[model samples]
Each structure stands twice: as structure tokens, then as C-alpha cells.
Target: MSISAPDVTPDVTPNAPWWRSAVLYQIYPRSFQDSDGDGIGDLNGIAARLDYLVDLGVDAIWISPIFPSPMADFGYDVEDYCGIDPRFGTLADFDALLAAAHARGLKILLDFVPNHSSDQHPWFRESRASRTNPKRDWYLWRDAAPDGGVPNNWISDFGGPAWEWDEATGQYYYHAFLKEQPDLNWRNPDVRAAMLDVLRFWFARGVDGFRIDVLWHMVKHADFPDNPLNPAWHVSMGEMHRVLQRHSTDQPEVHAIAGDMRRIADDYSTPGEERVLIGEIYLPLERLMHYYGQDESGVHLPFNFQLIDARWDARTLAQMIADYEAALPPGGWPNWVLGNHDRPRSATKRGAEQARVAAMLLLTLRGTPTLYYGDELGLEDAVIPPDRVQDPRELREPGLGLGRDPVRAPMPWDAGAHAGFSTAEPWLPLGADWRTRNVAAERDDPASMLSLHRALLALRRRHPALGVGQFRLIEAEGDVLAYERVCGDDRIVVALNLGATPHPVILPPGAWRLLLSTTPDPFTDTLAPNQGVILQPER
Candidate 1:
């Protein structure tokens, strides 16, 4: 089914500074909508869904990369930073999408991939032409070992050696991801200038901000030292589990570049407007806070991944929350993310019944919250058949189960053929239970998960404490997590039952008033299993 196009007239007035207190919806462009009957979603398809997104009460949309790529790692392996891939759409389609989104008060933030580029990129192509090319320094290249082996112990995110020997240059080029995606050499001044220009190109087009992809891997050690083998190999996530990643990625110099990027955002922001720059960093709390830099000048939001690491236990979650808040810089803005294109959906991670509870916790947290696509309807991960797997990581490391295809399934729009994603067969199949859990079916039922998401988002907007407030942990016992958000005159106490048993918490008499509850049961008496409650001081 084709996505119906919306009116694309441009808006003259400045949009509301809605991103400050608004929810940002993340769209995996390829799975969001299909307008050309090509089985894959395109820019026009996103334009068609702007109304739906606005109706869902999101103030901004963060689209995954649609840049020109070889699809080695989907659009993450960008060949041209300024151009859109034909699989997605042309430049005109993107302009139309931005116009349509702005008309509906929706700000747009495109994904910025500075860590690496496709081997087919012009820069990389020229860099690999010969050892003496002027652009040879644009990409990371190292000499092979004396035995004609890989340079170091570093492992590709997709498994095996991170360095691939280039016969043409008689040297090894580094690829933190698939071999087709070579890591850029940030040490080169010219490379940094070119990437900054790419940022300016999008900013000139009136983009609100950028979701910097793999922002931590932009720089590497100059000596190219070998990474020590990690003894705990099976504990890591994704393709990283295949081998130890010691010397290759996540170098300290990345912060200097991040600070420069922040300066660029500050330069672009108008007096009263905020131009956001968020980093995709997966690290411990102590290390994550450093990405914000010394004076809260670098990376407006470093993306707190505590929720991704915490289990369903109440005490464990409480500690994680406390640790993150404690480590945040004085004026640094905190951001919460429950799921993304790479990880498993929260619905599947936490059971179906607990998804709403998790959502309440996310929206009520004292920071910006990002919701992944299809998460509003509590969509779980789809089981990808082995024969149909397209992830290069899965193909390279069969035993490790490294692919992310299960979590990146097509979004379920309706209970139609291919879940109404496209008239033609989709690149990936829709979830099997799409008929029961979909936007169309949920829109018609007020009790559905989608409706709950809308109501909660609206509620979050109504309460100032949920957006910009001081978070204080409330005293609670086993299986119950409770916290109070206070902003000036507004004070809200949120309690969540992380387990499957009914839990009870003592509250001051007439001091608690039910504001929102994930479970259908009333919040006055006893909290049900897998329930969440937002309580305001009695009126």
C-alpha cells in the first residue's frame, strides 16, 4: 500500500521551541512508510506520515540515515554525506519532507555518521588509490605485520580483524564495521574540515539538529597499539562480542572534536532557539558523563543508556538512575533512550505487560525522552529466518548471533497484506502478530497501548516536572520503584511495579492523587502487577 502524500506547502513563521519539552520519535526510514510501491520506505513516505506523527503528539522526528550508501550496513555506511540514496529518495523528496514536517510544527534531525564512510565513497576511493595519493591520509591505513597479518588485535564490529589488507596499496585499511565501511582518519585536518562542511550543508537546509552516529568512534590512537584480548568476551553486545576491541575505537581525542561540533551548534542557534546535538554513546556512567565535556559545552545530550543496561529489578533500576543523575554535569541536560534500531525492542526485553510501565518511567524522567518507531504499540522483535538474513555480521560470525535484523523489522501499520507496509513484498517481513498490535487497530480503541502513549505524552507535557525538574528518589521496597519530580510548585510522585505480583506502598493520607496509571485498575487502593502510577500532591 502506498502512503498518501500530505500537502507540502512551506511554513513562513518560526516553529515553536517544542523540542525542549517535546518527545522525539525515531523513525527507521526504510521501515516507516512506502510511497512508491518499491517495498522500501522513502522520503515521500515519511512526508505522508507527518500528520500521523504530529497526531501522536511528537514535537520532533529523528530519522535514521538516508544518505547515499552501498547498503553494506544499510545507510550507516554513507558514500555521500549530502545526497540521499536512490533506495530512499532524491534531494527534492527530502526537501518536500522537511517542508511538510515544518508545516506541521515537527522539527527534523537527521542522523550524522562521522565515524566511518563506505569504501565506495569518493574520499575513501581516492584514499585507497595509492599509498602516495593526496587523500590517502583521509582514511586510517596501517602497515601489515611482519608476517603479513592484520595490524593489531582490534576486531571489526561485524567480527574478525578490523583491518583489511588492500592489495593496491600493500597496506591495511581499518573498518570498525563491515569491510565496505572504512573508518575515517579524524587525525587528518582536511578530513575534519570536509565532515564539518557536510554538517553545514544540512544546517543550511534548516535542519533542527543531528543524532550523531557512533560519536565515540570518531578518533583513534595515533600509535595504532594492539588492544589486549578481553577475557570476558561473551558479555559484550552486538558484533563486538566476537572479539576484544581494545586499541581501535573510543579514543580520548573524540571529546575535542565533540566540543568543536557543539561550538558549531551554538553558532547556529538563534537567541531563544536550541539547536540540539546528541551523541550515540554506549559506555558506563562515569565515562558517559565525560562526553558532555568539562563545562557542559560538548554534546547537549550524551544519551543515557542506563535503561538499556538495567534489568527489571527495582533496586537495580533505582541505583542506575541515581548513578546517572549523580554523574551528570551541573547544567548538562539528560536524555533517556529505551530502544533503538540496533538493540532489541523494550517490549520484548521487558515483557508485554511491563512495556507501559517502562514507558511511564521514560516519559516522567527528568530529561528528554526518545521513543523508537513501533514502540508506542508495544511491538516486539520479529524472528528473522536464517536463510533470509541480510546482516553482514550474521553471515560472518554465525555462532555469535551478531545481526540486528530482528529488532529492525518493518513497522506494523495495519492489519493488511504485509501489515500495510507496501503493496510489494517488503525487504523484511512484518511481525506475525501485526493484526492484533498495529496503529490502525489501536487508534480505534482508547484502551490500546498506542492510546496510552498519546495520553502519557500529553500528560508529560502538561506537567513541567516531567520535562525540566529535579528528580528525587522516594523511599520504596522490593519490586517497587518510586521517585518524585519537583519543579517549582509542581511535585509529582511516580511509582512503578517492575514485577508480576501486586505490590503495596504506604502513602501519606490524602497526599496522593492518581494522575496516570498504566494498568486499568484505579491507583487509589492497591497497585496491580506490572502497574505504573503517576501521583500528584492532592488538590
Candidate 2:
């Protein structure tokens, strides 16, 4: 059956926080829309599409980095933290987007890059000018090893040594990622003070929150010890994974920094505007929970990426959800992400049908859920011909299937030329099935992927159980995953069939009201392959 997007007002308990159950939609700016036909999506283009996002029933949008940069690593290498890139329009454009989004009951979050600065940034320029420069200690600079080799054997996330030798300064500077991006010295008080002020600059402009980039990598081991080598390391996984990153990330002192960020966000929040800090941490649940801090003075949400890294199986996912639920610290809210720019789309990793089931799992699970762009259309990774590849990762490590360009394709808004994303060619190629898979085509078809997302999002808002409920695994075996979500009087039973052939689930006896089905029409018997449904007491 066709469904309209539901009213997304908070239906949880009166005092419940918005982000606790909020569904955030991550916008890759370059791919979202192009207002001026510059072959790139900009802030003005995003503002033009605020109505579409509101119709999608998401609570907020997390835009990827759009700061001024050389685009060496996209906008992650920030040259100016306070100013918007000329390509993304001026600060006036950002203000307009913020105003438009807020008018629709939606929040906006800017990507905050705190761990590093672009090598071209003024701070880095000064630091590299000479050893005695005032800003020299603002970044990590160390003398070469006794034999004149690079210091400490740390490898860059892109490729090669993390230390870059500067002939002028007679020192090597540390960069965790691309050499163009120099790691900032969070250990230095002046660096800490300046970065925190950057937060204030934005908060004063009325941004709702920040998704801090590489939050764990901000604080490294003080002793500069070499990370222990991993026995299972392979060259294909990138050179940085050669070690376990024990000395580079998940440090104990990072909690204090997280608390400081939370305090900064809290300071600007009014009664209506409860600002938040979401840390982009990739550690295991045990260590990831620490970012929440002991007294709830840390990040509001440390992104949970278990769904992205886990083996796509019924039993494995069931246990992962259970374990993650158990591991959350007191007062720590859980979050889940199916895909992002760095990873392959969930639809590509799993088949198109299973992707719908995965979407069901993401929206109905406990805590906040982040929906990646184009996921609602069952968009998979586009095949980027070698000559057309734009991602440096693929260029640096050829033929490793590590390139992120495929998933960063422009949004297929319509069947028009350029798929209504741009008048000129897109920065990255659109999915091959753009004509059939575009939003305009799917919006009219009752059984289209877009309809299923609308239905599920409607169900999540209509029932409190699915959003802020207590969870319990009901069954997990034989390619079937079942669970119950309960919130006082509201109880929802979600059953998912993971296998290709029809799988019968012995649902507990009850008068069941079918709330939603992954399929278009009502089902009478067993669930079709990759089908899932939400049921409530048929009272």
C-alpha cells in the first residue's frame, strides 16, 4: 500500500530528548544538488531542497565538510574554519539554509574538523616557516630519528610515512591522514583554546550542533610510542591498518576533551535549542562508550558504526545489537549508521531487497539512526571508470575497491538531463540506473524503494515503541531476525526474513495489527525474500 510521509513531531515521553530518537540525514554537499549548475552541489542548492528533506521526515541534516580547502581530501583539509568556501556560496547562503531548515522543524549540523588543519592554513604556514616561529608548536613537529629516518614509524592514513620532512625547518611534521592535512597539537593549550573558539564562532551563528570529524584521532599518545603491529593486517586494507592504533586513538585523556566540547555546546543552548556534539568515533562499543563521559558531560552521541562493519547475517546482527545495547554506558544514547561517504552503500554490500530490510532494522532499532543520502532509492555504488575516478584513496591504492567515488555520486532527482542535480557534468558519475531509480520515478510507484522508506519513517513517528523503546531479541535463526520494541503501552514486533526463499517465523500468539510491510501489497502468508514487517496488538 502507498503511504504518505507522516508527521514527524516527537511522540516519545514528554521529557525525552529530541536527538535520543532523532533520525539524521547525512548530506554529501557536492552530490545533493547544484543551484547554479556548477557541476557541484552548494549551500544554496541545499537550501533549495529543504522542502524535500522535510518531506522525507528526517529530524535534522548533517552536511559534510564545506569549508575552504584545496579539495586534496575534499573539505576535510580545512584552510579556514570560520568561512564558507566560495564554491559553497558565502556565509549569507549558510544563514539562509539554516533559516529554511529551522522553519521546517529541522536542525542543521556542520562538520567540525578539529584534529587537523590544511597544510596551507595560515597556522600551518607559520608553523612550517621556521623552528622558532611563534606557531611552530601549534602542530606536531618532531626531529628526525638519529639515523635521519622519519620519526616513530607512523604511517599516513593515505599512504607512506606520517611524518613529512621539511628541509627549511629541519623537522618532520605529523599528519595522520593526507600529508596536505597536518595534525594539530591538541596537547598544546593555545591550540585547544583557538579550536574551542571556532566552536563558539559557529554556535553564535545558531547552528544546532556539530559532527566532530575524527574525534578519537584528536588526542594521541603523549609518549609517541609506536603502535603495536596487527597480526591480521593486510596491505589491501590500507597502510594505516597495519597497526592497531592503540597509541593514536582511544586514549584516556580524550574523555576530558570530549567533556570540554560538550560544555562549549551546552553553554550556547537555550531551552528550545539543546545543542549537541556527535563524535565520529570508530572504536569498539566498550571504548566507544567512553566518549559519552562519566557524568554525561561528553559527546551527546558517539556514532555507532557496527551495522557498517558487521557481517550481514541474521544471527550476527542480532548478537551485535544485543551486545551493543548492553555495552552502552549509563545515560549514553545509542546511534547507528548503515553507510557513509567512506564506505560502500548498504544496498551495494547487500542486495537491493535486503537493503530494504536493513533500512527497517536501522529505523526501528533503539536510539538515533543516520540515513545516508540516496539510500532511500536503493542506490548502489556507481561504477567509476578508471579515467573518471575522483577519490584519492583509489588513486593512492589502486585496484583495492577502497575508492569512495562510487557512493559519492550526485543525487538522481529526476529523469531530466543531468538527473536534475546539475546542468553540466557531475563531479562524480551518477548510478547507471538513474533514469529508472530517480526520486521522481520512485515517488509515483507504490512499490518503489522511496515508498518503503516513507512508510517506515511514518511508522517510526506514529509509534513510540519503535523509536524510544526497550528492545528484546525474540528470535534469531534460519535466516530470520525478530525483535520486540516496547514503550509502556506501545509494543511493536518486527520480523525480518534475511534469506532469498520464503522463511516462516513462528510469531508469538497475539492479535496483530500490521503497521508496515516492506512489500507494496498486503501479505497473507509467509514473508517474501528480504521482507520485513512491523506489527502491533490488534486492539
> Each candidate's TM vs. the true structure?
0.94, 0.96
Judging by lDDT against the true structure, name the best candidate. 2
Residue range 236-308, candidate 2, lDDT tens digits: 8887788778887778877888889999998997755788899999987788888889879889999999999
Q: Give me the overall lDDT of model 1.
A: 0.83
lDDT by residue for model 1 over 237-314, one digit each (tens)? Answer: 544654444456678888899988888887788844568898998776787888998886688888877797578888
Off by over 4 Å in 2: 1-13, 520-525
Instruction: Please name the candidate that would achieve the greatest TM-score relative to the true structure.
Output: 2
TM-score of 1: 0.94
